[model samples]
Target: MEMVRELASKKAAVIFTKSSCCMCHSIKALFYELGASPTVHELDQDANGREIEWALRSLGCNPAVPAVFIGGQFVGSAKDVISLHLDGSLKQMLINAKAIWF
Candidate 1:
């Protein structure tokens, strides 16, 4: 989401994703299409990648493939991100997160 992008602009970001996840790929592509690049941390490739997975589990998140974060704040899954973008809420979230100027 916008908040995630803002945090990423300020510092390196970690998007915990899985290689086999379609939604995860979509999220990455969305960022690319928007001219935002996030350092993806594929969970299926590393055990520590499960940290976010565990957090999501604790937060009652579905055992999904894309659990994003910004400045250590959980930003939900790909659907949530895309939905925000569609609703124009992501822009403010990004501004509030300080990822975009204007």
Candidate 2:
């Protein structure tokens, strides 16, 4: 949990993901399209992946991977991110977090 907190706060935007997940890739692409650079942690490649996933579960994230955090706040999962984007609020969220200039 400490590590999750640290990573979340370390960047304006962070994404906890698994390398081969298509939804994870889509989320990354979305952020890129929005001109926001998010710090991505590929759990599949990390030694503490299971522990981090466990921590995320404790935080109420189901399926854990592709969890998005903005400004140290757990924003949501891939579906939530897509919903926010479609609703036109994701850009503002990124701006608020200072993750994007615009």
Candidate 3:
């Protein structure tokens, strides 16, 4: 949990992902399309992968991978992000976090 928190806080936009996860890819693409240069942590490629997955689960990320943190705050998974996008709030959040210039 501490490690996750520390990593999340290091960037304005952070995404915890798994290489083979399609939803993770989609979420990353979404951020890229929005012009936010997010820090991506691939759980499958990390030594503490399993532990971080467990920690993210504790943080309310049920599936763990694709967990997003914006401005050091948990913003949830793909569905949550897509919802935010649909509601036109995701861009505002990114702007507020200074993740995207516009």
lDDT by candidate, in order shown = 0.65, 0.95, 0.97
State in Å the error of residue 51, model 3. 0.7
Question: Which tens-of-lDDT digit does each residue in 1-102 have in candidate 2?
Answer: 999999999999999999999999999999999999999999999999999999999998898989999999999999999999999999999999999995
Q: Which stretches of candidate 2 lie over 4 Å from their true place?
A: none
Per-residue lDDT value at 36 in model 2: 90
Q: Give per-residue lDDT, candidate 2, residue 79.
A: 91
For model 2 the TM-score comes to 0.97
Q: Residues 1-102, candidate 1, lDDT per residue (tens digit)?
A: 343334334543346688999988998887656545567878789765566467556755586568666545667777788888899876566556544446
Off by over 4 Å in 1: 1-13, 98-102
The TM-score that candidate 1 achieves is: 0.71
Cand. 2 Cα-lDDT? 0.95
Model 3 per-residue lDDT tens digits across residues 6-101: 999999999999999999999999999999999999999999999999999999898888999999999999999999999999999999999999
